[model samples]
Target chain A: MSQPASNAKPIILTGDRPTGPLHLGHFVGSLRNRVSYQDDYNQFIMLADSQALTDNMDDTNKVHRNVVEVALDYMACGIDPAKSTILIQSQIPELAELTFYYLNLVTVARLERNPTVKQEIVLRGFERDIPAGFLTYPASQAADISAFKASIVPVGEDQIPMIEQTNEIVRKFNRLVGKEILVECKAVVPEVGRLPGIDGKAKMSKSLGNVINLGASADEIKAAVKMVYTDPLHLKVSDPGHLEGNVAFIYLDAFDTDKAGVQEMKDHYTRGGLGDSVVKKRLEAVLQDMLAPIRARREELAQDKGYIMQVLKEGTMRAREVAARTTDEVKAALGLSYF
Target chain B: MSQPASNAKPIILTGDRPTGPLHLGHFVGSLRNRVSYQDDYNQFIMLADSQALTDNMDDTNKVHRNVVEVALDYMACGIDPAKSTILIQSQIPELAELTFYYLNLVTVARLERNPTVKQEIVLRGFERDIPAGFLTYPASQAADISAFKASIVPVGEDQIPMIEQTNEIVRKFNRLVGKEILVECKAVVPEVGRLPGIDGKAKMSKSLGNVINLGASADEIKAAVKMVYTDPLHLKVSDPGHLEGNVAFIYLDAFDTDKAGVQEMKDHYTRGGLGDSVVKKRLEAVLQDMLAPIRARREELAQDKGYIMQVLKEGTMRAREVAARTTDEVKAALGLSYF
Candidate 1:
């Protein structure tokens, strides 16, 4: 049953908000790591639709439609439903309850001072109109992490403080209850994180219109490669190119399996005589080769939306059991366990 | 069946934070009204343990123990379980989910600006250490109200802002989803809302040692009556007594049903012929009469804790069904209706 029980391995929790379809930036930063993590760790990949709603409450249709698109992307990129549990956040309901309890442990001023939330508020230009849920999202995230007792969370360096906050709640809950009912999690910061956009922005955001969707067609990939940000100072084939901030080079660095070949091309381009077209062709070819199988698989999965939903339903069912056990324990700790 | 099913009447939502045994201040201000309201309204009385955790997170046992005590207070005061549903808020997990959703409709600044929340913050001396749950309790209250589609919320005047916040969430949720999914609730502000403390303070509070519990013994009632505040200038029976700010006179006005006798006593006291001891003795007798039956019922119910728990469990089961239906509708409206 259940492939000889994968619970022997340590648990890792990771996923993206289902506000939009994922992109190459997501793949290079987190999804690729998660696909590998499923083998070594008991992985739970969440489709954070509720967290998506904290910001996209006005356009719920966008969040609803993207759940399937994001699921397709996950399956296409080889996130095996048999090995990894892929669940929707809203479906559990226990997470919300856990979040409610955790909110009591965190001070409002401390939440406002969370660097990630503070930066996001400014980035979204929320000013004084910050939705109460958006401000309390870190508490919600703490629930997501501790509900599974996940020991490992794969996130970027910018999200280290979230792990700290989760542990703070974990410690506070246990100390207040005089029992260790919840576990603290550690952030696993990847060395190769964050792929720049085709426009060379620090973040590949959908609103910026610079991101290439993971399910992008071959033509779309080719077009994006053609417009990839290259060194403007390198006007002629004889001129030496600067590799820093070059989107094509960055994508090649992230996708190319032949490290020696990429290093040779970089040297040739830096020393002059490597035409931009040649590098663009190589980058386009590499991207097409990497994404062709994923694109075809995504197309095939898209045809059977019912199967994807079934997988999520089963996964959410499994996830709910785990979260419910934790919630019961939390309630018991809080002395709220009524028969 | 079940007394012709009280679900036919308009629903009323009301409750107390079960942080302590309910007291005389609770009875005169709201419990008496609720006992009468149960026949005319499909009442849902919530034991707000979760809300109690907002400020009393460090002492959750207080919330837990008081749930049964408070339930005893209600049952003793003739809140028929067959007419009014008695539920523990934490038992209905859907309320937490609904609260998470409703929080998105309110802004951090908007919740911070609520006059009731603002005043309470200062009174509690929370300053910069307000718990996130405390800051967002209005959203939780909105969930408690709208989950039952409650149109009437019996509350004091100070709590009107909470009802306003609830309606704002209901309107915003319906307008956002383009459907009338949740009903707006109205605050039924009681004219005789507050009962002064034994020390003649504006409010009776347990911490101030000025409240008489609904389950107080006859001797306890007499002792509390003996300490009731009176006019300091009335040194002798010949000295004129001021009835204003005199807690015993106020309590007589609140509990003594014989209005003509109370009026006669007031006139005699104003005419400088009645002694303070006479009023205190009269208050003691009135309190003993009012509390005797209730105290007996509370004592009998306390002997059978399991039965009280079973009642709450059954009521919570019924409450869960009502809340679940509304949660589904809310999810459907938000386009989060994933199977």
Candidate 2:
């Protein structure tokens, strides 16, 4: 008898901290990619409110409301519920139990050595009194992934170490229990690293006030594009400009459809012929056109707040089912399950 | 309109790590006192399987089965379920979530500095590579107390700092949330410190091979009593014996009836008229009578293992209701509650 064919489609787990609404940076970084992956993989998109509160513990009110806003952004960005399962982290009690068990498999020093946590501590300036939640979040993330038995985790290149830590715990847990109850996930890095901000910073961030929101109005898009930073040396109509560090050209590369025309515009700018105002106007039109459909969908979603909340409520229930089943297996493997 | 009356009957929370069957040491240190508190306070007896797994993670089968065994011991010891809530720690998902939140309130340095933790580290020889779970257990204990709004935590004197840490988090959480959502707890140190082992060691422990389990057979009790440590300086029947450091006398003081006779026996032994054999026989009789009902009940309970399991299943369900409500309030205060 021939063996049954192994399931070919991979399971994908990805999420965002419900700290704010989605912006253009999120669109370019992961959300846009997630829309494409929806058809190829079984996806579980999580709103990591518990992890968000690890650092934003003082601003929980923001996290609480953003859970709905973030889910709405996902729906508006084309993460179909039929393709992706969206969930709130704290709603799944099994995740919390799994996290507690995994904490035993890792050491304090190892957590301290986690690159993502080290970078975050420096960025957040939590010198001596760092919260224990912040230090042990990698374990929490491990619980998040392993709870769904997700085989593929979409994360940035800088976050590969987090996947490493998760896989380490997965291996240790399976070895200790003598069963492969948990799945080890690999980090799927995107083709693009990160999109720069309108201010031309290395990365776009809401806290920096340089992000273009996914739901920007036409006038808002125009205003953000107008403020885009370019080479300061290109002062005159005929000045030779550098496109290497120009954010306007980068946006065009990331969003514009007329690649040949955009390249021609870039060459003209470098040859000291294209005026700065003329190039800015071209970039503005491309960005506005690219943002039009997304803005339309966001506005449509915004009109029905009740429907958006329903999506979250339903998704959270669905998520809890998968989470509960996974936790049952995990606790059974650990011999901690009473029922 | 008057203010809501403060809840008067002080709430008492206590538990045992279900690593093994309850022994004579547990009876003297806490269980005996719990039997009395049932009438005067709102009491909760938790079977701490999650905490036991911190050190016994490899022996989960033992931990899982012992949860019921310990609960049976409580029932046999007259810890009335009608007066006290008997629950399992791992079954309460809210406790895990509350522990996750409290982890942020405590610092790594502060956990390392806890005197009881330091002493345990030395005792266990976990110099540098202590499991993160063991390191964070005080925070977990804090969650256990605060989850029930427990006002009186019955612990040994050595555990005073743990209660202090719990109160610290309670105060900090209330101050940070700008609401009195958590209540500070007071430690109820029992009148006695600890019961020494049959070998006359400082403490009775399962690994130490000196414990007299509550369910020991009569012959086993006789054998254990025969091995009781006495003053070696008194070699003959007429030789004077010292009673100050005798562990047998301490056990008698804590467990035996006929205190006047026990005191007379102590004086007789020290006055060089009584021998170790007479004292040993008397101690054996008192212990046998004390444990007779407990052993009988334990045997009857052991005959129907399913019945014991049912008790825990029902208790855990009841415990989760209270825990869920408390966790909701806690998450709301921290701003992490998505609902």
Top-lDDT structure, candidate number: 1
How does each model score on TM-score? 0.97, 0.96
TM-score of chain A of each: 0.97, 0.96
Model 1 chain A worst lDDT window (10 residues): A1-10
lDDT of 2: 0.86
Report, to 2 decimal places, the DockQ of model 1.
0.83
| lDDT digits (tens) for residues A98-202 of candidate 2 | 898889999888888999999999999888778888889898999999888888998988899999999999999989998878888889998977989999998
lDDT score for residue A294 of model 2: 77
Judge the docking of candidate 1 as incorrect, acceptable, medium or high.
Answer: high
TM-score of chain B of 2: 0.96
